[model samples]
Target chain A: MSDAKKFMYINRKAPYGTIYAWESLEVVLIGAAFEQDVSVTFMDDGVYQLTKGQDTTGIGMKNFSPTYSALGDFEVTKIYVEKESLEERGLSLDDLQHLVWEDEDEDYAEKDSIRLVSRAELADVLAGQDVLFNF
Target chain B: MKLTIQVNEGPYQHQSADTAYHFAKAALEKGHEIFRIFFYHDGVNNGTRLTTPPQDDRNIVRRWSELAEAHNIDMVLCVAAAQRRGIVDDGEAERNGKDATNIAPGFRISGLGQLVEGGIESDRLIVFGD
Candidate 1:
């Protein structure tokens, strides 16, 4: 109920087609522009948002993933990913140009911040935040 | 934890609604209070009362209604998006000269400010999109 000093933005969709991904990114940028402590996490198909070498020119849309790299410049550097998602999609940290933490450890389930987490761990993440915004 | 869920995708068109449903149910089951479920952009389609999927398939519209009815969850459909898409209540439908209003009963037509309020009031304002 109080002012949001810390913000966590969850992105759950892929880029292109719809504008949800774009809007969510804009909101995070705005939050960071205001000096808020912003953390962004990509889940589900949203993992595609951070995939390297995206080519949207053929689709008649501008490639926007590169803009995500600018988040670090805005001080919005805490980027998280669900480890299981990466494995399920055959994606590793090397496939992404951005900072990605894959919780490949068996003990990740026990340690709250040990890298990757289950969908259930999201509740804890949300519970600990002053603000949890998903897109 | 009190939370607000912002839905920005159409029902069944993507996994966004499913994610919202599971998360909402889990949040409620965990004794967390839900402040509201605000629909925007393509999400306004979720309030359509006339949707009829195959009998063998999932009926997301009905599922949403049941969730709202059971939990007393506030279901908000964006007024601007609804107007833009021609999804309206009886009055707006009449004024617009449309034959019928497709928005269901449990969901309400509201402004984007409500979403901002959700961000301000709830401990978490989760968005489901794309």
Candidate 2:
């Protein structure tokens, strides 16, 4: 665990319409077992995956939006949402889920995991990754 | 270099599978080691042994089976993805009550943890997606 590699799941597509979003989430959930330094990025249409009030009954599909909250429990504490992508799609931080994680080292202190960053900032983050699982 | 490949598209439906095959071949020809080739998403279709293409066409599924056999590559189709798309192995068929198994040779069904392991152990983890 001390030598955990930086693993990032880059989401660029929307949910439901295609299998990419759901399958991408599936990969992330399963990858949690590795106990790596994991992060997820929501950009482009991927920003829509974190929106609230998802109703998939009409689409005859399982609503997987709530799974975002469980990511914190998987030890994936970094969830990056690009500010430019949100603004381009007429969205703000308020439109997304308020995801948080608990720090066991600090007596389980609750901490916000959703980190809002500019496109440039996200680029820097992407560059620092040891492994990037693109979706 | 030790490499791993994740194919996210099915054979013929998209160029991803084809490109990944070529890339793996090129790498092997250059004396590179393929740690694993984990198929996910629609890529599970690559493992089905039921495919039958025209005689003149390149048999994509067979191509993969042959490649893996030749290189002794660990070619895996994600269990969840394969189950969703109806790609079944003998063990999976018995477990899921499926009458038949469609998984090809040189391939096996496994969990997504395999993909994560590839990312951790390989020198590079390349993805071929839509």
Best by TM-score: 2
- lDDT by candidate, in order shown: 0.77, 0.94
Pairs in clash, predicted candidate 2: none
- lDDT per residue as tens, model 2, A1-135: 347899999999999999999999988998898888899999999999999999999879999999999988998899999999999999999999899999999999999999999999999999999999999
Cα-based lDDT at residue A41, candidate 2:
98
The best candidate in terms of DockQ: 2
lDDT of 1 by residue, A1-135 (tens): 444466788877888966778767766765564555567788887777888888887888878787877775566656777776777889876676644232346543322221356667766776676777767
Off by over 4 Å in 2: none
Candidate 1: where is the Cα deviation over 4 Å? A1-17, A21-135
For residues B1-130, could you state the per-residue lDDT of candidate 2 as single tens digits? 9999999999998999999999999999999999999999999999999999899988999999999999899999999999999999889999999999889999999999999999999989999988
TM-score for model 2? 0.97
lDDT of 2 at A15: 96
Cα misplacement distance, residue A104 of candidate 2 (Å): 2.3
The DockQ of predicted model 1 stands at 0.21
Tens digits of per-residue lDDT for model 1, B15-63: 9998998999999999999999999878899999899899999888899
